[model samples]
Target: MYLSQVKSNGKQYIYLCVYVGTQEYSTRKEKRVYSFGETKKALIKMKRWKRKFNEFPNELLNLGCGMENLEEWIRTIETGITKTGRIFKTNVKRAVF
Candidate 1:
């Protein structure tokens, strides 16, 4: 199973929980971001990976530290254009509706 959540800091994180090996539960997750999904799935996936490697991979996940598309974000910010930007802009339309 897979699960995801948006964090208070405005980041999206995903976790996977599955029984991939002899283990009955497993879990995988972003290192930092939203962290520790609200469900049991995350634990399940971790167990699976643990069983597969017999140890942790000893690597770091993106953990949602940087924007997934930093360049696109930069372009939008530079152009002062984007759905979110437009919506949040201070304008007459926003003041009325």
Candidate 2:
């Protein structure tokens, strides 16, 4: 997601461009643009979108700070193993048992 500014007929406008993956095999990507007219509301929306995308998740494997919640983490692993009937690779440096 990104923001773009455009000028038309002496009026400047802000646009939010979101890259959406296409379902069809022929087209790999598509752009979804949302126009927020030059107004205070547009600024607020842009800030909100910027905040949301700035914290986007890049990977699912790493749980940096969440490692502190040992019990919940253990439960999650156990539940996943039970449901999938397979063991997942974990980077557990120490084990109580």
Candidate 3:
């Protein structure tokens, strides 16, 4: 899944897109849902949604890499500080969750 931007009627909007079908079979079609305005905010929202729903593609999870990769993905989306006030940085986006 990825973020898509579209322009229509002189207005630009961002949306979240996911491919249709399961890991074994793909219809080669995309389903776009959830429109947002700003790119950064949209990304943040999408990351939160993805994490909350465990929206990672089944193909990736089924690759035998298993939960290790899944945990890595989650780590990338989450960033904050511990009780010691030390910052935890991730190579991926800095999400609030």
Candidate 4:
């Protein structure tokens, strides 16, 4: 189910305070929502969300790999999901796709 989704910087992020699953999913267990953005920007947004809910956003994301769906699809090329609960910016090329 979708709720008050953020339209910031062409990415949609769901927050605990603004998300409430639909009726079909009676139980609103805010879980992995997908989003996209630069690492710094995403973390800033996450920090804001944590400030409001006192909790972290356990989101499922493409890690901001290039947006494509071919054999080189950005979404499909990422290594895997990470659950880091802190903000970090890196100059390492390997870290970013």
Give the number of colliding residue pairs in candidate 1: 14
Give the per-residue lDDT of model 3 (tens digit) for 13-91: 5554567765446554676644445445544645654566466445444534344433443343244332344553323
> Which candidate, 2 or 4, would have the higher lDDT against the true structure?
2
- Model 2 C-alpha lDDT versus the unseen true structure: 0.40
Among these predictions, the greatest lDDT belongs to 3
- Candidate 1, residues 3-83: lDDT per residue as tens digits? 223334543333323334443353533323233442233333344443454332333233232222333322332343543
Error of 3 at 55 (Å): 19
Q: Arrange candidates, best lDDT first.
A: 3, 2, 4, 1
| Clashing residue pairs, backbone N/CA/C < 3 A, model 3 | none
Error of 4 at 83 (Å): 6.1
What C-alpha lDDT do the candidate models reach, one value each? Answer: 0.32, 0.40, 0.48, 0.33
TM-score-based ranking: 3, 2, 4, 1
For every model shown, what is its TM-score relative to the native structure? 0.22, 0.30, 0.32, 0.25
Candidate 2: clashing pairs of residues: none
